[model samples]
Target: MSVRGFVPGVLATAAATACAYAVAALVPALNPTSVAVLLGALVTNVGLNRPFLRLGTQLAARHFLRVAVVLLGLQLSVPQLLHLGGLGLAVVVVTVGLTFTGTRLLGRWFGVPPARSLLIATGFSICGASAVAAMEPVADGDEQDTSTAIALVTLCGSLAIVALPLLRQPLGLDAASFGSWVGASVHDIGQTVATADRVPGALTAAVVVKLTRVILLAPMVAGVALVRRHRSPDTARARIRPPVPLFVAGFLLAVAIASLNAVSPATLSVAKDVQGTLLVAALFALGTGIHLPTLLRTGGRSLALALTSWVLIAGVAYAGVRLAGL
Candidate 1:
């Protein structure tokens, strides 16, 4: 598509994202990312998403999200992950692996399609909407599948910001333990931060643990690509030649640069701001693709899968945290 074709949609998405930011600022409890998705959905369901805006929205949803994921790597530090210690690391790995595998199996049992299942599993297992976006090309899911997965993950993550903190005391978790659990269970980094921030001394652990899970995203995508290629060598070869997508490689490179402390704090801070804005905008674009009536009709099974996955992750992470004595 021509660059000009994307202008209208991109501009519309930008406007919506700005609105989302404004609303989030007014409502301190709300996340801009969540607000962006809602605004996009509202516009689409209300029939305001015009034909001329489609191309730009599509571009924003796909390319902009990928770029945001790349910038996300700057927030990770290798040494910080190492500081999680052996048992803490084990908790993260086991929780992610089990949640991912179990969610996929649950999707199959629910008769959900493979692509949507994979996207859901990825989103719930790794890092929410960003993970869903990253896995889209590898899974060969359509826009609907991507939007559904993003929606489910976003909802559950938002709920976590409230529910988990309330459970912290009942669960008998201290600040550090709560942080570990939040990091393990929450889908989005922002949600994790929100939940963990409710308890003093929890944010650092939550962020570090969440970033560790984010680190696993690249390998997970590559593994899925390899499995797909193995199952259908010819078709997969034609479509997905690289096991690791270029954007994923960029993510890794960004992580390495961050680890090396190559970028100055000022630059990193600016990159972080840009990353957040891009992600919010991309989510708004993705939201535009959601048809509320259609989503309501098809959401039953996906909602069940999402809820089940949410409980599974929380339970497993709780057990892991307790076992690890975090």
Candidate 2:
């Protein structure tokens, strides 16, 4: 695409993201990504998306999203990672593994296609829409599949923000336990943080546990790449894709730099702000690509899969919390 074509769409996405952030500031319960996505979808469905804008929007969704993810690593450090300890780490691993594996099995049982199923599994288990986008290329999924997965994950994450807090008293969970549960179960980092913020003393544990899951995003993507290559060596030979994408490697590098404590806290804070803004823009781009009618037509099976995955993660995380005595 020419510079003229690209800049307009990117600018439009940035404007939409700004609007999303403005809304989020007033309505704290509404995530910036969610708001961005909704606005993008609303604009496109209303026929406002033009040719030049479309190219930039696609670029935002594809490239900016990865950059945002890479910046996510600056949010963590080694001591914090170790702070989770053996028990916490074990719980995170088990929860992610089961959610990823179980979602796929359930998808197959429901007769969903493999590529869509894999994207859904990755989105639900790893990190919602970001994970779906990261895995889409590897899974060979279409735009429809990616959009559907993002929608399902976003819906479930939204529900968790409300439902989990309501269950806190009935579930007999202390702030730490509740935070851990939210971190484990919620699909997105923002939603997890929002849920945990409802309780006193929950924020620390929640961030730690959630970051643990975020760190796993790299390895999970690599693992999928390995599995795909193993399954079809001929195809692998014909077209070789790296097990770890460059952004993921950058994520790891950022984590390492942050762990070293060489970067100042102020710098890290700026990075976080930038990351969040990029994510908002990327999500807006992804949202613009979604066709609501098309999603509705094929949403039934995907909805079922999302609900089942939500239950699985919630149940498993609850059990992990109990077993850990958190």
Candidate 3:
């Protein structure tokens, strides 16, 4: 597409992203990405999205999302995962792997399509909306499937911010243990921090554990790409697409740079801000593709899968944490 074709949609998305940030600031519990999706959906459902905006919005949702995913690597560090200790690391792995595989199985049983199932599993098991965005291309999912998965994960993550804290005492977990639980179970980084922040001294462990899960994103995405390539009927198309997407490689490179401790704290902070802004804009674009009526008609099984996946992850993480004695 021409640069001129992208201008309108990009501008529209940018304006919506800024509005989302403002709204999130006003409502601390609501994540900016979630608000962005809602804003995009509202615009589309209300007929505010014009033809001129279509190309640009599509660009934001696809290319811009990849850029944001690459930048997300700056937030991770190998040392941080190491700090989680062997048992804590094991907890993260078990939680993510089982939740991902279990969700896919549940989706199949529920008669959900493979693409939607993969997207939902990625969102729930990895890092919520961002993970969904990263996996969409590899999963070969349509916009509706992508939006549905995002909505499901975002809704569940928001609920975790409220529900997990209330369960801490009942689960007999102290602040740190609760933090570990929140990290292992919560879908998004912001939601994990929000949940753990309810208890003093929980934020640190929560952030570390969450990053460890984030670190798995690259491998998981690569694995999916390889599997998709292997199963394709068209060998020519399979050969044309790399087994690992370029953006995934960029993400790994960013992680390596961060791990080397070469980037200044100020630089990393600025990159984080940039990443968040891009993600907000990208999600808004994707949200524009959502038609609420259609989603409502087709989403029942997906919703059941999401809820079951949520419970499964939380239960598995809890068991792993207890067994590991984290």
Cα displacement (Å) at residue 28, model 3: 1.5
Candidate 1: RMSD to truth? 1.2
Worst 10 residues of 2 by lDDT: 236-245
* Full candidate order by lDDT, most accurate first: 1, 3, 2
Model 1: runs farther than 4 Å from truth? 236-240
Residue pairs clashing in model 2 are none
Model 1 per-residue lDDT tens digits across residues 1-326: 57899899989988998999999899877888899888889999999999999999999999999999999999987997789989988999999999999999999999888999999999999999989988998888789999999988989999898899999999999998899899988998878887898889999889888999899998899898888877887783546478778899899999999999999999999999999999999999999888989898888899999999999999999999998898
Give each model's whole-structure lDDT: 0.91, 0.86, 0.91
For candidate 3, the clash count comes to 0
- Structural similarity to truth (TM-score) of each candidate: 0.97, 0.96, 0.97
Q: Which segments of model 2 are wrong by more than 4 Å?
A: 236-238
lDDT of 3 by residue, 1-326 (tens): 57899898989998999999999999988888889889999999999999999999999988888899899999998999889999999999999999999999999999999999999999999999889978887888788999899888988998898898889889999888888889999997877887888899999988899999999999999998988787884888687887787888899999999999989999999999898889889889989988889988999999999999999999999999899988
Best by TM-score: 1
TM-score of 2: 0.96
| lDDT value, candidate 1, whole model | 0.91
Per-candidate count of clashing residue pairs (backbone under 3 Å): 0, 0, 0
| Residue runs of model 3 more than 4 Å from their true location after superposition | none
